[model samples]
Target: MKINSTVLLTLILLILMLGAGSLSAFLGFTLGSSALKGVSTPDGRPTTKFASNKATNAQQAGLTLLKEEEILKIVKARIEGKTKAAKSEKLDEDDEETKSSKQKPEEKPQEVVEEKLQPGFPVTAENQGVTLSVQSVRYSGGDLLLKVKMQNKGADSVRFLYSFLDVTDDKGRTLSASTEGLPAELPTNGPAFSGTVSIPTALLDDVNKISLSLTDYPAQKLKLDVSNIPVARVAGLL
Candidate 1:
């Protein structure tokens, strides 16, 4: 059968339309699978895989930077705290030392001793019709010369034979004895007999208790009682 030109054109158009629709449906299925495969991620991100990865890397870098900053801040704080503590400790030590230096030392007290005098009823003696009273007794010495002054207050002349000075301590213990030939005799009218006694410095630590006793020649039995003599001490004597 012969077809008109208008009908032929219509038929061709319909065929072309149908073929295009079928081709479109096939292409949509094939491309949809490829697009779905390309868009899917294991972690569930959809359209922006490359951008998401870049964002994740950036976030990790930012976290690392923040951790580093935190650590540095902690270290700085620790250093500053240690420095302040050391400064405070040094100040406290210095203050304690200053207080100790300003403190004063303690002082010792002084001691006082009173002097005692002898009792009354002085000792008396008579020999060869003459009586001699022993008066004040005194001591004098500097270097090697130690002398005792004995005043005779009696009216008659008496011979002081073998007179010796006995030096003793406070406890009545004899420390030293004077050598012989101290003073031969005492003239009645002359100033009371003065005798030079030799005593080493080691023997006389305390010279306050030294006694001077006299013995007469004719009798040689009676001892002159002349204790409690006022003894003096001289320094730098060897």
Candidate 2:
């Protein structure tokens, strides 16, 4: 009975040892193959929580970069639009100014024209078959200019006596001229001549009539009268 009890005890101990070894091997294989849920790398160096935090941070950074780029593009477009609008406004203003300038009035095209004025009237004088015709008169630059046409129906050219042309107001006021020192300039063209005569503009003030007495020595005298002839203003100049 002692010998049989010892053999049975040894067999029981060997079976327990074999079962413990199989349980240890099964637990090791399960832990290695079925990994933890959030671990990222194959080496399993990062914890599951650490890997999740890293992924969240990378996503946030990428989103922030994209938003900044969108904002920059919007700002750039706005700036470009503003610049173009300013240029367009300036061009419109310039075009309007140019149009206004073009519509403004300008000076007359001709140098002079015939004007019937109230300060003086046409007059004529004849001496030795020579006739002097005064057409029109005007004032400019403190001087009086007269349009005079001269003709000789006779053989010889007639002369205009110096100191014979005189200006007088109705009040007997003798008007003086700043250009009184200038002598009469007669045309040398034979038989017919036409020109303008210049004198002092101040002489026509409140004047009624001007007289020119042409004489042939002590023989005869031809008298001409200019009355109420209008004086014209100068044009084309300031």
TM-score of each: 0.31, 0.35
Pairs that collide, model 2:
117-230, 118-229, 118-230, 119-229, 119-230, 120-229, 120-230, 121-229
lDDT for model 1:
0.56
Number of colliding residue pairs in each model: 0, 8
Model 2: which ten-residue window has the lowest total lDDT? 177-186
**Model 1, 8: alpha-carbon shift in Å?**
99
| Candidate 2 local lDDT, 70-93, one digit each (tens) | 999999999999999999999999
**Candidate 1 residue pairs in backbone clash:** none
- Report the C-alpha lDDT of model 1 over 1-238, residue by residue, as the tens digit: 3568889999999999999999999999999998888575566555568888889998888863448889999999999999999999999999999888788565667667643322321233444333333332323352223344444445554555443434555568775555433345555555644445555556555565445455666755535544554444534221
lDDT of each: 0.56, 0.61
